[model samples]
Target: MQWVLDHLGDISSLGLQHIWLSGVPLVLGLLISIPVGWLATRTRWLRGILITGSGLLYTIPSLALFVLMPLVLGTSILSPLNVVVAMTIYTIALLVRSVVDGLTSVPEEVARSATAMGYTPARRFFGVDLPLAVPVIAAGLRVAAVSSVSMISIASLIGVSQLGDLLVDGFNRDIAGELFAGVLASILLAIAFDVLIRLAEHTLTPWRRVQQGGGT
Candidate 1:
């Protein structure tokens, strides 16, 4: 506690960097995953290939991915971009299946009704399919968000500064206070991500609230 308070400024700066490292990847991953996921849903064969391939990506060891990012991306080993890109790959790997499942969760009859009402494929996807898929997609995003926050700490091993730095430094120096601070901060950040995602899910699914209200 004393150590944390003493290093408050450094801790705060690292927390912001941690947020940037994790948050940017999450946004970029979702943007990329939506189209990829949608394309997968268009064909059975492609669906099997994309979902299976992406799932395999998540199985790669995180530290190995972090080390390999510089080689793959031609970025400096110490460059924050290496972490960002690697994290984005991970985020996409985790979320693509969720996107596919969410989109497919839409009822077939509802989709046909949208088409019969003169909705074009694009319009129907964005207007009808997406809204209905929000609940499931949001559930996936919550998992991705927490995972990102926890994983970004690994970047510190390769010299990208973030909350993980405290964990490493504390362990080496035998400073229990600093180590505890790092663990506590990481947990808090994960919880914050979960809460924000839940709030966004609630906002996007107003009908859920209405249903609960009526049932009550």
Candidate 2:
């Protein structure tokens, strides 16, 4: 407690950096995943290739990916971009399947109704399909958010500073309070991400609330 108080400023700064390191990749990954996911739904062959290929990316060890990012991207070893790119790849791997599932979850009747109303492919996707798919996509986003936060800690091992610094520094120095603080902070950050995603999901899907209200 005393250590946390004394280093509150440092912790706060690291927390903000942690947010940056994790948040940017999540947004980027989601943007990229949407199109790829949509493409996968367009045909059987594409679905097999894209879903399997993207899913395989997650199997790569996070540490090895982090180390390789600089070589692949030509960024400096210490550059935060390496972490951002690697994390984005991870986020996409997790989300593409969710987007695929969510889009498929749309009722066939609803799709037919949209088309029968003369909605174009683009219009139906945006206005009818994507909006309805929010719940499932948001579930994936929540998982990505929590996973990104925890994984970002690994960046500290590679010299990128964040809350993971606390863990490394604490462990090296034999400071239990600091180590506990890092663990606690990471958990709290994950919880915060989960809550925010849930709130966003609720806002985007008012129909769910309406259905629940009507049922009661």
Using lDDT, give the best candidate's number.
Answer: 2
Predicted structure with the largest TM-score when compared to the true one: 2
lDDT of 1 by residue, 29-124 (tens): 999999999999998889999999998999988999999989998989999999899889899999999999999999999999999999999999
How do the residues 1-216 of candidate 2 rate in per-residue lDDT, one tens digit apiece?
999999889988999999899899999999999999999998878998999999999999999999999999999999999999999999999999999999999999999999999999999999999999999999999999999999999999999999999999999999988998899999988998899889989999999999999999
lDDT of 2: 0.94
TM-scores of the models, in the order given: 0.97, 0.98
Candidate models: Cα lDDT each? 0.92, 0.94
Where does candidate 2 have its weakest 10-residue lDDT segment? 36-45
